[model samples]
Target: MNLKKTLAVTATAIGLGMSIITPAHASTGEENQESPDACMKSQSASVFKYAIYFNSNYGGAYRNVGYPVYDFADERVGGSPQAGTQPLLFCHGGSGNNQGIKNNAASVRNKHSTYYAVTYYNSGYKGSSDWATPNSSRNLSQAYNQNASFNWSSL
Candidate 1:
């Protein structure tokens, strides 16, 4: 084939490949914003959901087991507590500090029935306990444990 034809064919193939990879709704003229149908979709629409359990102390009198599950299937509408969704937990990225996931109490609570942010500090770091203290970590951990006990389907 001539150079012009070869280049045209390659460009056409690349365009076709990208279109195939893009979602159907997105491939259409839809803007980046999510539609109300997408927004209302619940956690039940998620492909992954599960919980995590841990013990404060293993095999000892002081040991206390806790469950911390992350269920993606709780499809409560975001920012609507009246939707009867499970309490949402927001954990800040990379160290999970207050600044990482900082939000006003009311703002966080508005996401669901209950909302919590988890903060954790690096172990053995010599610094004031005021920032990301162990107590806060434990408290958030316990909250996750309690929330994990629910059957989100009923909510």
Candidate 2:
């Protein structure tokens, strides 16, 4: 082909290719990125009626609990006696997403219709604690980020 015709074809092809190539864009779509932990099996069996927040005022990543936790640390997870090696963590997409829930929570919501969720500053459900009434939410006053255990009671 002639130089002009060849140049014209090349230009058109380049233009078309360039047009087809869009600028890469960061994904704005949100998805649950939390990986399944070993204790998830037991978690599914629990009620998960309590929400523990990473920030006061019920903000940031949270973990929902159904049963009592003697220690936020390992050796026990929630109400299960399985002695899980994996630590409990907050849900994804929040301020403390994928972070450990022990001693890191600052707020809580009691979703249980008939039970009170208690957060303790010391492990084994002892020491200063903050309680959230059934179906209530509260910013941890004593426990705050020093929380170490959790339990639900009728009182």
Candidate 3:
């Protein structure tokens, strides 16, 4: 083909490609950008629940529980515990129902909002204590591992 015809064809192709691509890119960008109200609404639709992993760093067996879990005695609390194995616990800030987790947790992840999940070494929310900040995760100290009796209010 002549140079003029080839150049014209190339320009037309480029223009057509952009026309096809622009709308798709624009729509996807809009979908990905969520408004504050929309984000809050979607978040509220689901209850605030946190997961407790048996292994460290949020791995191994996991249980997603709502606030106010007093005990871990109920087999249903985090599903049946593994046979012949004491799984370490990991959790963020939330209410601990009572004495069930008195001496069971190994680690914790604090993902609560602007509050710390205070873990008590002894039951009844007493004894030595450790606190985790919101949106943080860590392995508990040896003294606190398998020694969490209660989860008190945020710090």
Candidate 4:
């Protein structure tokens, strides 16, 4: 073939090859949403009621392998409990719930081997003791200071 014709054919072949090539992308479009279930058994039965009790009575529960929980950050104090060390958790009662908390305190304390007490205030609205007041600065300040005084953040 003549030089021009050979060059033209080579150029056409190169253009076709370049058109077929694809630029690399970071990820594929498809992804698996769930993995195969492991041979894990459910222990949710005990975890649910106990966790609820802890939250209602003790602010929160200690972490366990099979349970999930949450609590107000302002209510808990963390400290190392040595062999003979006595730890305490105070539950401030809301409204006329003093009797309820008082009755449960011993059982909770026994379960944890730690002192549990209930704080009762003047008769007021339901839910939280501090909710009756319009301004929460006093409440927040008290909560922050109390938690800070005991260094609850460390726990």
What number of backbone clashes does candidate 4 have, counting pairs of residues 3 or more apart or in separate chains? 2
lDDT of each: 0.22, 0.63, 0.41, 0.20
TM-score of 3: 0.44
Write model 3 residue lDDT over 24-59, tens digit each, in one string: 111111221122221222323323323344445544
**Each prediction's RMSD to truth:** 18.5, 22.6, 22.8, 26.7
Reference-based TM-score, model 4 = 0.14
Per-residue accuracy of model 2 over 6-98 as CA lDDT, tens digit each: 566457535634211111111111111122322243333435567788888877777666555656664342223553344567774569887
Candidate 4, residue 44: how far the Cα is off, in Å = 43
* Model 2 score (lDDT): 0.63
Best by lDDT: 2
lDDT of 3: 0.41
Rank the models by TM-score, top first.
2, 3, 1, 4
CA RMSD (A), model 3: 22.8
Q: Give per-model TM-scores.
A: 0.16, 0.64, 0.44, 0.14
Give the clashing residue pairs of candidate 2, or none.
48-66
For 104-149, candidate 4 gives per-residue lDDT tens digits of 2211111111211111121111122211121111222222112211
lDDT, candidate 3, at 29: 16
User: 1 or 2: which has the higher lDDT?
Assistant: 2
Q: What's the CA error at residue 132 for candidate 4, in Å? A: 20
